[model samples]
Target chain A: GAGVSQSPSNKVTEKGKDVELRCDPISGHTALYWYRQRLGQGLEFLIYFQGNSAPDKSGLPSDRFSAERTGESVSTLTIQRTQQEDSAVYLCASSLAATVVRSSYNEQFFGPGTRLTVL
Target chain B: GIQVEQSPPDLILQEGANSTLRCNFSDSVNNLQWFHQNPWGQLINLFYIPSGTKQNGRLSATTVATERYSLLYISSSQTTDSGVYFCAVDQETSGSRLTFGEGTQLTVNP
Candidate 1:
């Protein structure tokens, strides 16, 4: 596909279980981002991966949340021992570069998102 | 952290009507983009207008960077345009992590 692709459009998991959501960005895009949208809420930034630089995990709600990008391509967000509050839509987006001035952040394309429901 | 606010939390318009959504940020942003989340949960980038005005079809957006406010204009409303329109901004201080508005839920009635 030409756009970002996410797996497991919907997932139901036990509160104690762990879940991993995947994001495949457009081929050759250099920047990737992960965000979460709770019910009736706006998107909250999670992490950002740019080229080989360290990922900025400032928005990660807790230590239990971690993500990694391989070769500036596929990225995965893992929630360990998921809590009910973790239930929400996990969104993935990829951009061409950092600032829109020179890089045209317009490269950022969003995926359909994976809906996780914790029971 | 910068504060972002969107007005008219909800709006209902008849097809072919025009409407505007506003987003106000507490600080200046060099990066601002408008997105539309369709009913099917797809986030479509409407415009990456950080400043000035940009138009595409029936949609147009303007961002007053110095004033810290942006507006999205939708002309000729259609059922397909019924969805949540989000305004996201990235403060250079934040390193590209977009801070999004609560969004304006627009409903177009036939």
Candidate 2:
């Protein structure tokens, strides 16, 4: 089975530029999540989507960060006017379901991650 | 938000040895998982134990949700086992959002 996949394994952009990272979750997965991992640091929750419900944007660091998922398949995280502080590895993950009852047992499959560098 | 912490931020071990990694959380959680971030930057799911103990080959994990802690044990460590180990949890208040620990950087030398 195909695991979650992310595009632009490596991205280099100048400060103030905008970038979009893509994610392809495993087929049939109803939940998708985005996270950021700074060098030698832990994963920081960004946003999540479950089926067709409204996405969870509470974790978005600021207005410059936003993510969208269409039909529970592909997701894109966009960072507008990126700053050097935004440099990090963007990771995507997915689960079978994310309802309150089933979420406790869902195992998230992660993508290889996209390393974004802001110079 | 629940606070998660992993002890011994870094560890160095010799091949064929054994080691234990610990994770502690500040509150109750409905889900607890262990992951290994390989040298190539791929996150691999190792365990999905919210409670009880499970073993896979030389690796095993035990999560005591009641105590808000978990332990991962590796026996006969191999050079390929060198990587960052992370513990993440989904608190009752956070639905499926996983709060991750700083991770334990492990280095296994042959």
lDDT of all predictions, in order shown?
Answer: 0.89, 0.91
Lowest-lDDT window of 10 residues in candidate 1 chain B? B89-98
lDDT of 2 by residue, A1-119 (tens): 47888999999999999999999999998889999999999999998889756457788999999888888689899999999999999999999876555244378889999999999
* Model 1: fraction of the reference interface contacts it also forms: 0.64
Residue B63 displacement in candidate 2 (angstroms)? 0.9
In terms of lDDT, the poorest run of 10 residues in model 2 chain A is A97-106
- Scored by DockQ, the top model is 2
- Clashing residue pairs for model 2: none
Candidate 1 docks at the CAPRI level of: medium
After superposition, candidate 2 runs with Cα above 4 Å error: A100-105
Q: Report, for candidate 1, the interface RMSD.
A: 1.9
The candidate maximizing lDDT is 2
RMSD of each: 1.3, 1.3
Worst 10 residues of 2 chain B by lDDT: B89-98
